[model samples]
Target chain A: MIKVRKLVKRFGLKTVLRGMDFSVESGEFVALIGPNGAGKTTFLRILASLARPSMGLVSVAGYQLPRQAADVRRRLGVVSHQPLLYVDLTAAENMTFYGRMYNLPNLNDRIDEVIELVGLTNRRNDLVRTYSRGMQQRLAIGRAVLHNPDVILFDEPYTGLDQDASAMLDEVLRTVAARGRTVVMTSHDLARTEDLATRFDVLSRGKIAASATHKDFGSGNLLSFYKGVLEEGRQN
Target chain B: MKKIIEDRSPLSLRERAEGEGKTPSGNYLRAIGAVAWKDLAAELRSKELLSAMLVFALLVIFIFNFALELDVKTRDSVTSGVLWVTFVFAGTLGLNRSMAIEKDRGCLDGLLLAPVDRSAIYFGKAISNLAFMLIVEIIVLPVYSLLYNTNLFQPGLLLIILLGSIGYTAVGTLLSAMSVQTRTRDVMLPILLFPIILPVVIAAIRASGAYLQNMPFDQILPWLNLLIVYDVIFIAVAFMVFDYVVEE
Candidate 1:
């Protein structure tokens, strides 16, 4: 679970997240949609213990962040826009490397399972540098869940992926949710998000402007809703 | 006094942790080992970092040979200093390249996501940088000896090189992690590292010069103490501040 109360993140004169409040319960698949510079990544980074909020209380999987971040990291898995894969390392090597870092048991077997899950088994021995963007994105997905974390955060994972790759990512997230892992993914792709997300929250101008369940979302009207939110945000 | 104690009690959690107390569940030794091993394995596969550092170090030594016009007398006197200077410069090269690889390729983010101690990443990189410096030193010592027919196999000199490399790499690793994040990147490493690590360079050179001169242990002891003091202080400082440097 992730809980954030009145979070405010600013860099000098610029405010990124302004007194925002949000939470994601266990096994929930929530899509965090926002425009560029709307602070979705900032919020996820804060929860990931990779960034400190300028002001707020944040607890991830019950460990308070910026204070008990190390404990929280044990339960948290993050996949950002960046693949975070070492280019020179083989897919197997990267997973083994991270497994050692997490001190995970049965390292080789875990690496195999995760690589297989990402559908990179055929190219597991090849350097990640040679992988396509889609392959790298899938590898990033594999790496994040390798530790079987309680909370997983993805920021703009759909960037630079083909349709098939996107579909593969959607299937992967569905499988992950079935295994009962909480996922908070941010994206601008409303259609893809609509397919994978059970719930959606609109972030505009550093605040949660609107939230709705997937059932409340009409597949035909979701794009119109997203456009309306953007128009309203721009007008303000 | 009572008011101050009340104000300080809660903040003591930070103070205690900073004082090297319990850090969640991870062992410092395991954390350090995991980090160092990852770096070493990665480098062994890529061979980019070590190769760049080795070639750069050799080039620096070669330039010094021509620039200083080292006759027989000056070569013996200046060899240790020259070798260390080369190591220091080349060490910076390797440190910058290593951290930059992590930053550019996003490996740093993956490492940060791991449940291990953040200091493990710091020490891991530091130890790997130290290893590279030592390996280069070992290779250079023989090359220098062969070039000038001077004996560099002295145990005392080897010890100085070890201490000096540790001090240099500890601070260099920390500063490189910071510098790589900035826009200036590789160019910024030496600018940030050299000034802060001046004490290490000074002590390393002096102690090395002393050993080469066959000076007594008493004469060389102060410089060694300086190295130890520097190693302790910066290692602590680097460990404490690593979280800030790596934060997104």
Candidate 2:
């Protein structure tokens, strides 16, 4: 569903993604794990067509990067550290606005479905500014999936959620995965992602140093595996 | 020969519909309308931006009253300049704050992700910004007329106002998108905007001044033409380049 070859992203004198090659098949839930400044979010932004790569051959759902960006955008959804929502608009209004942008058919029905899926049915009419951070994040999720995108990218979506909100988000993510869509999520919370993601990739120094499926670590410890990979990267 | 071939090319209705979702042009127009409606609706609910612009405009007029000492004869020469100056300053305030709100709220990124043509976003924002400025101008005109006892309601003056605003906002919207992304955004907008928009303001003041002073058609025609030319040139330039300005 997604492909990247020798992906290199540079900002002025600094380089963030360095010669990275990655691919994901349809319905694969990938947990892109990395420390700060390790280029996880940068990679996701490139996939979402929000940033152009300095050099790479990248494609999402068969559309080329930067050239077919509008086509790619129509097939993908993105949730960054910021919710990317208007705070003053109500939840339903936000969904309706995005609905129009995607030119969806029967938009009112889709808005209702996504709002209920996020469990914001009762609060849908309230202004987003009046909601808590968790509620806003939920609405962001609903907005992302409103048009039924083929791929969804989540960048640290649980950054500022409480315990209950985190649990709620987990259920929502599980539901999304069950629908068999391509999902790439970047997170610092390894424990939760370990249970959710089918594959785990450790990004270090702008490259994927280690990657393993859940079955590869069967009866083994993911924390120790991650630590060993980082230590190995440090030595090399 | 090329024109004949182009005209002879087949345009199957079903293929066009499939290529660009159902009713492509209609959907494009709807997207533009949706964006404008969202901005206007948010402004209506908050009233923060409009109120600030209105109060600042009235305050500027009051200061001008004290600073210029507009006794009957002097008022005739200076009222158009004062009103145009007031609109320019107040219009910048509105433009800067409007773009800043979108940036701070992450709405700009949200809009960028939309599948529609980027120019639709530009037109939507320009239209909304123009609406806000017009609302302020509409209210301020009568108030200024009453205070200075100058008939500011001339039909030609109104046309000039509309034309000048189109030129101001066409450029202002593009510049505001650039300025809001900079480090010193608050100070950046006026600095970037005023220099570029000087032609629009000058033509507007001159044409408006001529209209108010009951000048001959020959005297008024050039400034009016200048305003139209400025509006057309900038609107076309801004529309063509807006995609690059909003790129991350």
Candidate 3:
């Protein structure tokens, strides 16, 4: 489980994650939804141990970070706005490289599996530079899961993807959740995330103003619920 | 290429490993080796970075040939000095391109996402940068020898190459990482890198020059010692500062 208590992060005078608290049990799929500049990325960066929290106790996978981040990074897989694949290498070579980075056994076989899983098997031999944005996005997904990380973080992975690509991504997320891996994704598209995430945490003004499970979300009305949350924040 | 934005995910390693029964630290070296191997293999196929560096080194040498117009009698003493100048400039080209490839293709993010020590990434990149510099030096050596009609094969000169390249890339890797993120990107690499790496390059060239002149061990020893010290200091600084460069 990942536990974050009293988390606070600041940039100069601007506070990003302000006295935030959150936790995720194993296999939970939590979508962190917020507007731009809402500190969603800051919260996630802190959780990923990429940035240090100004004040907080974050215990992830039994590693105390930023103290034991090396340990934490090994089990954590993250896909941010960047596709993060080497353009000079083919998709196969890229995945193979990442697989080796994680020291996964049967690296070649594992690379093949991720390539197929992301449906990039045909393009596997092509240099990633030749890939369309959608193709590169798929390969990015493949790279993230090459090691079968227990915690998967996706920061707006759906941006720039077309409908077909979005559907493919939806399937990928479902497949990952089906494997019981913990997922924390931040997205602006609440409706698209509705069927994918098990829970939604609304980040507003540097804190989680509200949170809900899919069960409590009610009647498949994600837009209304999301709008309501935003309106509630505005009123106060 | 778009810059890599920070992604934060809340997941703990122990929980991930509890199911897989693998320790995170156990895989660190494998991660570094994998990154290094990937770069080496890619370079072997394309030969782009190495070739560019080699050509650039030769161009600088030829430029030096006309620019200096030194008598053949004085060539031996200046051989190491001239070669290092070529190497440092060529080294920056390789480093910039090396890092620019990662930024453009989004490979740096992929590497960062992998469950490996960030230091592994630093070392992997430094080693690859060093390798490219070495390969260029190796190819350039014979050509340099042929052109200058000077014996460039002294074992001491080879050692100098090793140490100089290490010091060069130690700081080169870190600075390149930062430069690649800026709007100016590839162009900014040398601008930022050269100032910081000045000490290393100076010490390297001095030591390399002394070694080539067949100076007594005592005369060459101080510069050699300086090279070693600079290499160690930069390596540590690079390792510590890499996190900041890569941070989203």
Off by over 4 Å in 3: A214-217, B1-26, B45-48, B181-192, B237-245
When just chain B is superposed on the true chain B, each candidate scores a TM-score of 0.86, 0.90, 0.88
lDDT of 3 by residue, B87-193 (tens): 99899899988888887865676676565668889998889998899888898899888888888888987897899899999998999898888899767887888
Candidate 2 per-residue lDDT over residues A24-119, each given as its tens digit: 998899999988899998899889877889998999989999899988888788887688888878999888888888787666867777888888
CAPRI class assigned to model 1? acceptable
How does each model score on TM-score?
0.92, 0.94, 0.87
Give the alpha carbon lDDT tens digit for every residue of B1-248 in model 1. 11111122433322333345544445566667777877787788889888988899888877777688767766767877788788888888888888988888777877787766788889888988898888888888888777667888998888888888888988988988889889998789889988998998999888988888778999999999999999999999998999888886
Residue range A73-184, candidate 1, lDDT tens digits = 8777788778998777789988877776766665687778788888889999999889999999999988887767777788988889999888998887777777677899
Worst 10 residues of 2 chain A by lDDT: A214-223
Question: Which of 1 and 3 is the better model by TM-score?
Answer: 1
Per-model tally of clashing residue pairs:
0, 0, 8
Q: Poorest 10 consecutive residues of model 2 chain B by lDDT? A: B1-10
Residue A92 displacement (Å), model 1: 1.6
Best-to-worst DockQ order? 3, 2, 1
lDDT of each: 0.82, 0.86, 0.81
